[model samples]
Target: MEPSSASFIHLRIMQLVGYTQLYYCPKRQNLVRSNILVVYSIILCMVVITWLIYNLVDIEAHWRSLEINSVMETIEYINLIGSGAGYINSIVQSIIHCDKHLKHFKKTMEINKLFKQVLKVYVPWERLRKRLGTVAGGMFLTSFAATAYILMIALYMKWYYYIRYWLLYRILYNFCSLRYFESYMVVSAFKWTFDYLNKCLQELSFLGGKHMDAYEKKNRKFGLYLTEMNYQKQSHKNSVYFRFKILRNIYHLQWELSKVFNDIFGLSLLVNIASDFLSFLTLTYWMLTTMTTFSMALVDVVALFGFLICLVPHLLNLILICRICYLTTQSVMVMFFQASRTALFVHKIPHDPTNESHIMQIEEFSLQLLHQRITFSAFGFFNIDMNLLYTIIGATATYLIISIQFYLSAQRG
Candidate 1:
């Protein structure tokens, strides 16, 4: 009944599901007031979309008229819009999925209070909140710095023809940056989920020992402790019940979280992966081409390095998400194996603390754990993890090489 880390995660999940806000039931005024914000947001989104489409068309025409070198010069600045497009698409997908996710999560929570409570207990909110705050602050600073640097470089270069283009690009950049903020939310959820599962594994490991300890205490003292033995036995029995309850809840929570991940983030992740892939490829191409002068080459190197620096948070986010999800699966597997060992050991020990019901429930939980599957996939097409990251990098490198070869061939022709 006490608030646990799992409870905190459920609170966050509710916030994302929109049941707390979007469907807040009260006076009619509350519904109207809540919807007013949604209406305002939709209007602003329409404006941004119209503005971006116009600029993208104009820029594409302009770039076609420019020489190859001139086109390449803008590649670094312009392809950012592509990343922006991905981010924008992701935000849109989130909006589309919001209601459905809300309905699904709301129904599940109503039906399963124990799962909600257990899920929240493992979140470690103090540490997670602090880390989330730091991540947000860093992202804000980086965005501000990057914008200032772009403005300065534009003024120094005095490329008036591209000034309008730059402004439009930055506008898109600002809009797409929302994707990162959204990502921060998703990653934070995952961080809490993975951390909770690890805690569950620890609880599972100590479960059998606790039972054995209680049994040993009763035997060692014999009739002298008979009065205390009943109390201790009941207490330990409750403890075993609580631990098994947590294990059962964990399996259910994983399924719920995976559904949340798929509904709310599937398209968004696809957008992010594609956007990052293109950004990295563009940076690589620019860095490799400026070999004619040391100063020019030095500038390219710096640009590439700075670009990569900016990308570190996003890249690290991807890797951490994958690692946490993957590790949680492995941990569950370990827990299942430990349960088998405990069951075998329990049979060997006389006067076991656990009742037949406790053993039956655990065996059921272990079987469920075997069948459980959890993954963060983009649009259900591919799982997002370390393996996906490696594949993206390899694909990007291959394409970058091919594009360079084609460009050389074009120049010769």
Candidate 2:
């Protein structure tokens, strides 16, 4: 695989985290030794927390009395704890299952070779690379902007409060937030995988429509062509069959991946999504309802920009995965529809026993597609397509309305 290809994203991430050791180190003693890095991360979290507490707790009472300042500090601490704990937890689990999971992933890739087929139709690798890079870059830039704003706040408060504590808080919070960033990489990889699959399905739709035309147009004598067309019909059938086989293999691989990462994904996403939604709603509430000084409002505005940077791209990543899956399944139906139309056209021509095999071939390809529709589901909860997108939107709207109501009631009180 090319260095920038989507298929290698997961491998690169594993290598960065040193999980690749589990794959190559055969001896049990080496395996155990290699896992020390993963284990060390969990221990480091504790050490970091201790260091943060030692510095932070020594801050003056006057700083803690500033409600807005305190609220922001509390949020930062909560973010730090949430992301750090989640990362440590996931790392521990991954380390425990390191050998088995890595082995399984490798064996799956070797045996199925579905990724190779995906690359066939998933042309223009540059587009995939650019799309992923743009989204991820936007996310990191927003995060950095937010961190920069936080630094300004720290610097501003340093004169009045403890400079050392502010610096410690800023550094620790940003470090821990890197965990959520790591989770984004995994989600982005899955999104690209499905997207590539979707593109392949679209290509298949075109091929299905042209299957007969290409076969018929092949150069052969008039009488010889008629005879050869029937035999070539089988080739079209085999081509359709092979495409479906590769698609089925992709679905299975998706399942295996989903299963392996379900807990980590489910929990990480749950926390990230929940936090993001709350941040979005709260940001809205802060903007619409609360009055503040111009400087504080500027802080809010910059923070809002940062939050959107992180929130919008990540949400779009999920939405795109859903949208592509929806489109791919619909494309399969379109393929079937076009094939059926071609079959009907084949029947319209005057009866010629010489053409019987070709006619039957078209009908069979259409029938196969009609009966075996492709559906993509994420961990079997529900299909991860436009339908999931609709559900998420509906839920978000409902919560936003409720939050607005509460905000207005508080204003009245």
Whose TM-score is greatest here?
1
Model 2: runs farther than 4 Å from truth?
A: 1-33, 48-81, 96-104, 111-127, 157-229, 282-289, 292-413
Off by over 4 Å in 1: 1-33, 60-81, 101-123, 174-177, 220-235, 292-356, 409-413
With candidate 1 superimposed using the best TM-score fit, by how many Å does residue 67's alpha carbon deviate from the native? 5.2
lDDT of each: 0.59, 0.52
lDDT of 1 by residue, 72-165 (tens): 6566444656755664575466456656555544533432344355434434446766676676567667666666665655576565556677
TM-score attained by model 1: 0.75
In order of appearance, the predictions have TM-scores of 0.75, 0.61
What's the C-alpha lDDT at position 21 in model 1?
Answer: 27
**lDDT agreement of model 1 with the native:** 0.59
Lowest summed-lDDT stretch of 10 residues in model 2? 23-32
TM-score of 2: 0.61
Global lDDT for candidate 2?
0.52
